[model samples]
Target: MDFNENFVLGCSAIGAGLAVIAGIGPGVGQGIAAGHGAAAVGRNPGARSEIMSTMLLGQAVAETTGLYGLLVAMLLLFVKPLVG
Candidate 1:
């Protein structure tokens, strides 16, 4: 490939790497949320519905960050925004 093409690919790879880094926050947050949810369930099994609903809602919201990261990575890898 040409020097410019190689440079763009390298930059895209770096951008994808940086984009994927965003997933860490959602991952850690989801894990903490899940742990707390499990603990809440253990403490009060009767409120399972409420606890589950709230946990799922929070997890889904938190997961958006990871989704955005994945989207950015995918765009970098596949969409080839820097190609043109």
Candidate 2:
């Protein structure tokens, strides 16, 4: 369309790319949490239920970051707020 529109679209694409990077943190965090949880359960088999529940909860919380990143990327690509 116009120069400003083109610039906004380009910037939005870059920003969306950056936003998707947020998924990395949650992936790492969840992996570490799962590893630690498994270790903890191995150390104390009797506490397996507690460890599992806590690990699942923590993983769910950590997953929100990735979900947020996806949402942001979707909005940036589809909404085109700045371009408008």
Q: What TM-scores do the predictions have?
A: 0.88, 0.80
State in Å the error of residue 10, model 1: 2.0
CA deviation > 4 Å runs, candidate 2: 1-4
Superpose all Cα atoms of candidate 1 onto the true structure and report the RMSD in Å to 1 decimal: 2.4
* Root-mean-square deviation (CA) per prediction: 2.4, 2.4
- RMSD from true fold, candidate 2: 2.4
